[model samples]
Target chain A: MNLIISTLRKDDLYNKKIIENIQKNISNVEIIYTEDMNIKGCIGCNRCWLVTPGICTIKDDYEKLLIKFLQSKQVVFITDLKLGFVSYKLKNIFDRILPLLTMNLRFKNGQMRHYFRYKKHYKMGLIYKGNGNREFLEKWLERVMINLDGTSIGTYNIENEEEILNALINC
Target chain B: MHLLIVSCTPRAKEKSNTDKILDELRKGYEYNGNTTETLYLYKRNEWESIREKFYENDNILFALPLYVECIPGIMAEFLETLKPKQNCNTKIGFLLQSGFAEASQLRCCESYLETLPSLLGCEYNGTLLKGNMFAVSFLGSKMGKQMVEPFYNMGKYYAQNNYFNKEVVNDFAKPEYFSKKEIFLSNVVSPLNKLFMKVFAKKLGCKGSLNDKPYQNYIKR
Candidate 1:
């Protein structure tokens, strides 16, 4: 399954474009439009890692999305550039996904990382607009994927719709 | 000038590691005759007031826990509300701590934190990166308090100078990577630690298995 999350507005043309392209070119896609959802940011509660284990205590709209994420083999974060990084909407989703990982520390690739709670090999991709401070962001994305034990498929500027489709299709 | 210490930890005040670090720093800052106000961002209703205080102060320090290899999601949202100020003399620095022992786990986030002050039109005060925060459960223990006691000295240095002491920052972010021998030991201990987490969760009265896969069947792999 390919899970594509967009922080774009429900009425935005780019949001529709990305989903339409994914639907046409990809199979078994789960599309999440952030503006249409009401999810709060993670409060740094340790309940997900301790009490419930692989479940967040916040009890918001994110649980349905989290379940979808576990089933996904690939995820593409569709967002706008904000302060040289992904938008807060996309960032909130990333933070809330902490339940997917355990609190235990392990060394992988010479870095300390949380062990996976579930056994799944997932890949991540990014689609964003603008080029403000992209060098750091690209590196950051690679680092985030490394923590997930996944490889980043890379980023696509808004104009490179074909490149994105090709990457997903080939992924 | 007064300092405004902002805590980006979304955990409750009693359970926050960042809050404890800030307490030590504030003690040093106040002892040096510099007054300070510490703000916690977890109080969603107080953001409007927090933003006002942030704008009013010139020396600001954001102390945050490293989550998901970056700033916490709530911190990101709060940052989004801040607009770039022009001709502002506010200087910003960071106290970035991680539970992980290696500096490599925090390098990317540190890079991002370094770029933050400049992007907001504030002077870039250097970030103090440290690892080995370990766990919140142990932070309340006597041994844990001893571990963070050294940050008091950092607070004293900040009171005299606006930024973190460079020598201390270097020392704190130690063992950036590991020796080849340590890597071998890490490989040996990784599985053991995984088992430890399961045991710890059970002791905490966890209602379900630590490795339960409640949503695994959503897609056929």
Candidate 2:
């Protein structure tokens, strides 16, 4: 299943439209709006690694999202821009996703990386808005996916429906 | 320079690698008669005050661990709250450290940070990139302190000059990426390293396998 997560608040008209448009155009995707959720950022506590084991210690709506991601083969993030990167809410989501990975390290394609806890590959794509660096976002997504033993589906702009289609098909 | 050092690690000051490095940095920075103050961005309730500090300070340095290949999410949240400084002559810099040993892991983030200060209407004070920072957690106390003690000299250099010294930064960024030969060597030693990590995790009270998945049912894709 493909998961399209919008990190923007649901009330922002432009953000809501962007998400609704994706829902209308795309097939077989589940959308998540994080702004209305009671999610907190990961505090770098290694409890998931040493204590809970694949379960984040923090109790929040993100636990459900992590389950969705574990079941998702393709995950595309929709982020409104902030400092040329994804919004804080989206970045917070990314940080909390760490529990799906093991604290143990292994070498893959020469560099060291954390082993995937669930042993599932997750191809990642990005849809970004505002005055952001699209190239940098793509590179960031590509690097992060590679670390998870997955390939990049690349990035797209809201208006670039053609690129988004290509990326989703490719993902 | 009356520097305002912002520690961006989500961990508390006592347990942080950022704290260890910054302590060494402060010792050297203050040695040269430069005064400094600190603020923790993890305290969300104080973000309003933190924003105030950002505006009031002449020189600001962000010391952070390379969490998930970039700045921590909370720090990203704080940075989003900041508006451009307009005419304020605040010079901003980054001190980025990571648990990963390779410098290549940090380059992508470094590239992003190069353009960050200019976007906020501030002068770039250059980034101090370091890796192999898992020591603070995995190593003994003395060994961990020894590993970060080099930041003292780096702090002294930054205090004397306005930006990071290229030599220390380059030394910290050794083996930016591995060559074919280095890869072959690293592959041979990979098993030993893995065993060491397992033992270290065990010592830190990891109850089960490091690869244990309590939520294995979530993988039914």
Candidate 3:
């Protein structure tokens, strides 16, 4: 299974265009419109680790999303660049998925990082909708890939819709 | 110079390690006879008023703990609310702390911090990244005082020169990457560390549930 999470505003022209394109070109993929979700930022409670262990204490849409994430073989993030990084909307989702990882630390690629709670390894892809510096985005994504214990197929700007479709289909 | 310190810790002011560092910086700023005002973002009720404070101040320092290898979502949301203006005179600096022992984990987020001042047309004063900060408070005041002395010096220098001292910043972000010796040591100690954590959790009455899957029902569907 494949998952596509898009943070495009509902009224933006690119929102409909990209959704239409993805629907036409991709199959068996679950696409999530982030702007329409009732998601909250991680409050840094540490409850996911201390209180509930592998579960987030806060009850929200993220609980359902995490299950989808773990079951999927690939996950793609589609977001606007805010201050040369992922939008806070998308980042809120990213930060809230701490339950997917265990607090146990390990070394990966010469850096200390949290170990994965689940056994599955998913391929990750990114699509950005704004004019952010590519170098910053690449570095950010590289760190994200490490945390997810996943491999990056690549990151594509929204202008490259055909390439994104190809990447998604191939994944 | 009037310094505006923004504490971005989600924890309450008294319990926050980031605030403890900010307090040290405040002491240094005050000793220099400079005025400092702080806005705590954890106090969500004041965020609207705090948003206005950014435009009023010229020297701004953002102190935050690294969350998931990046700035916390609240800080990102706060940044998103600021309107971009040309020729803005605000000079921005950042203090980033993390639980991880290696300073390299904070490097990726530092890139974002470097770009932030440019996005707002503010001059970049540089960022101070510190790791292994989670242990500072637990180590008690004697050790805590020693650890935060550099931040005090940083604040003192910034108050006098309008920029963080390059040497101090470099020292604060030392051992950017851990050595192979350190890695081997960490590997050897990891199991023991896990066991100790389990014991600690058990003391808190949460031992067996550390790996509880509360959402397992959802996955089964």
Highest-lDDT candidate: 2
DockQ of each: 0.66, 0.69, 0.57
Candidate 2's C-alpha runs over 4 A off are B165-168, B179-186
Best by DockQ: 2
Under CAPRI classification, how is model 1 graded?
medium
DockQ of 3: 0.57
lDDT of each prediction vs. the true structure?
Answer: 0.81, 0.82, 0.80
User: Deviation in angstroms for B194 in model 2?
Assistant: 3.7
| Whole-model lDDT, model 2 | 0.82
lDDT of 1 by residue, B1-221 (tens): 58898999888888887777777778877885789888889888999999998888889999999887788878888988998878989999899888888776788888888888888889888888778876644545676677777788888878787787667787767888888899788788878876777787788788787766666676444
lDDT tens digits, residues A80-165, model 1?
88777787788888888888887777677667777787777768889997655767777878888877777888888866889888
TM for every model, in the order presented, reads 0.92, 0.93, 0.93
Q: Using TM-score, give the best candidate's number.
A: 2
Worst 10 residues of 3 chain A by lDDT: A43-52
Q: Write the per-residue lDDT of candidate 3 for residues B73-139, one digit (tens) a residue.
A: 8888888888875667889999899888777888888878888898887889988878877756645
> Deviation in angstroms for B72 in model 2?
0.6
Model 1: residues >4 Å from true position, as ranges?
A: B136-139, B165-167, B185-199
When superposed on Cα atoms, how far off is each prediction in RMSD? 2.2, 2.0, 2.3
Q: Between the candidate structures 2 and 3, which one is better when assessed by lDDT? A: 2
Candidate 3, CAPRI quality class derived from DockQ? medium
Candidate number that wins on lDDT, 1 or 3: 1
